[model samples]
Target: MEMKNNTVEVNHIRKAYGNRAVVNDLSFVVKPGEIFGLIGPNGAGKTTTIRMMMDIIKPDSGEVKILGETLTEGAKNNIGYLPEERGLYKKLSVIDSIIYFASLKGVDAKTAGKRAEELLKRVDMIGHRQKKIEELSRGMGQIIQVIVTIIHSPQLIILDEPTASLDPVNAQLLKEIMLDLRKQGKTVIMSTHRMNEIEEMCDRILMINKGRLVLYGDIPSIKAKYRNNSVLIEFQGELGEIPGVTEKRPHDHAVELMLDNKTTPQMVLETLVHKRINVNRFELSTPSLNEIFIKVAGDERE
Candidate 1:
């Protein structure tokens, strides 16, 4: 339980329903003051894992140490969580709902009121402060849930699909708030399907598939390891088969060349030129996070 400097430590955790294991021997660590991404495809048991970590449910095996201690009533005060599903009192006014959630975390009514005002303003929802939760749009409701999640300014925040309902502008606003939290040295665990957001905001990522870890490490290293194995080329003339190119995919007017183990980008470029292919553009490129996600998770039909 004494995880010294780590904020979260999930060790060999396993969960099952009947004979099917949803999460199998999963283990990962989240460092303090960093944005950590928990990512996987639909039904990959991401929410189940998060539920176990939050103590909303228990793992069938192994342990979860949160903030260096076993989760307890007092420990819950230091954590904030936004479930994937929206849960708000529809009859309650926006301000009242915020205040109620804050109060549950030991925030005084008056102080919670002031913080609610600031948060509402920050999210550009101050005008809807007195409206009932049922009266707001889906996007507006998502923002309210976020306000409720962080009303107490907890040290560790866990968000599941935090931007699911927002428009581009509102999603950008939420992303900004997340960045601000990182600046404040708060540990954030974000589980979202948006790979662009994950790549942009997370310091490290733990990618899971079928409830097991597929990739876990700092973003740059993972990208370097998986991305540099290919190159992009745009040529005008007829393309000839190039040696050392293991796979080729036509991308628009260009081609993406996946190199073999011993082939480098420089070698490929030299071969293209030597073969008299009129190259328009030849550049080394890295695969996007989305591409990597698909490659690792694979097709469900498969």
Candidate 2:
């Protein structure tokens, strides 16, 4: 409820094009030193919302506050933003492009140049520093973009699908960089459809569907709300209806037993042991963020 201490406070923002409302009455807050996730299905108005937050586009109604104040020309310098769309000066060398972007954010050439070398090395792209942007691969370009985004050492960082062009190794490196930024007390906002990344990196998440808020909360609380009501087991015996399980979903190598509230996973394991079933693996199954995403967004379609 209090907005002053928050890094970002978005209140009742709405945006529409002609007849269709792309973002409708969306509101959320990002706390200082936390990684907040903004997620939704494609065409769910995430980009529209980010654009409004950056003041690249105006919302039909509502307010967006960055670092507790409305975005100003001077305030822009303290924030690092990477939009979904990627762009760079094709003719310029990698180091040149990084310095150019930093200069735009008011970082002097001396400091920017020093920071550029450090960041390029950090991302393992120092060897490509002299290459023109047009000559680099997609993953290489993404690394450069990331370096450019944070070269100025902004207080707040906003990235939309920052790992979209990266390989697994590069993506992992970026994750480390982001985690390091958080440790430095910089606030981060990441917008992506990668549910695994959301669960692993974000402290809180806001999910929108068809331009409307569907789910919003901390990761633990949200998963606890959809608490594990099933158990997965790998066994060799014929799985006749167990006493506590209501339904059995079969797999080629395993079976998931849906449990009633009255039965615990311990009870099911005991039942299997008593029946002489050779249990290789058994554990309570919690709903993954990806499953929850599909459920919430899929329900919107039906």
Candidate 3:
């Protein structure tokens, strides 16, 4: 058996439709046993890149290596892929539908059926195993889709917006399952626009926009690189007044202060003390993934 290390590698990949490029010169790697986040805005070439990786669509240029080898039928069978735009057979019962999809992934029918039932139970959908797909709620069907995606227990699972159309309870369950998969030494490639999920689950991330790589690295390092020169303060009564603060946004007795180029956090504290301001909390923190994501991916401000 090959020792676990780099699970996926995409080198200078590019894909196009007619004259329009979808994924332009994109490149990234997914390490084993980690949730690697692939995030971008709508029409940002996320799906295009994923398809190339799966060999569902060939990249116009570049190569994708899985488990240190070229993609093949064996590679595809060992990978679980849940597309963003997905559907289950409406006329088929839940268990049968799950079993069918898992079988397509090369799992034996008996094993697929058994694993499907267990997964449905885990997601609190065991009672509806016999129900037709159309009979279940949208959230329930989405859960089933996820179950099918992982029923084969593949080494690499790629989820494209897996939490879409799911309720909070099921969403939390899916998040827990993703984390558990990581713990079991399974590599997951998650593509989503949700910053909270990325922050909570991904060990590293690659952010792309307009079919080009924008940001790539571990979350903490990216946060540090994009740290806004600001302080988040929580104090009682009133903020009163403080110097060196270029701008401020207040919220529920707390304020986010944007400091001037020459203003230090220490100066702000000293000023507060000299002014006799009641201080409850003083902290300087890195910018959130949401903020940085918007900065790189655009917030539709243009």
lDDT per residue (tens digit) for residues 77-178 in model 3? 889889999999999999889888888888889998888878877887889999999998898888888888889899999999889778899899999999
Rank candidates, TM-score, best first: 1, 2, 3
How many steric overlaps are in each model, in order?
0, 0, 0
TM-score of 2: 0.90
Which candidate do you rate higher for TM-score, 1 or 2? 1
Worst 10 residues of 1 by lDDT: 1-10
Off by over 4 Å in 3: 235-245, 248-251, 270-277, 299-302
User: Which portions of model 2 miss their true places by more than 4 Å?
Assistant: 1-4, 234-244, 261-280
TM-scores, each model vs. reference? 0.91, 0.90, 0.89
Would you list the clashing residue pairs of candidate 1? none
How does residue 32 of candidate 1 score in lDDT?
A: 87
After superposition on all C-alphas, the RMSD of every candidate to the true structure, in Å, is 2.5, 2.7, 2.5
lDDT of 1 by residue, 1-302 (tens): 33257999999999999999999999999998899999999989999999999999999999998988879988898899999986799999999999999889989999999999999999888999999999999888898999999999999999999988789988998999999999998999999999999999999999888888889999988888778678899888877688999888889878999899899999998898898988988888887889889988885327
Task: Give model 1's clash tally.
Answer: 0
Cα lDDT tens digits, model 2, 199-262, are 9999999999999999898998998787668999998877776897899898678888989999
Q: List the residue pairs that clash in candidate 2.
A: none
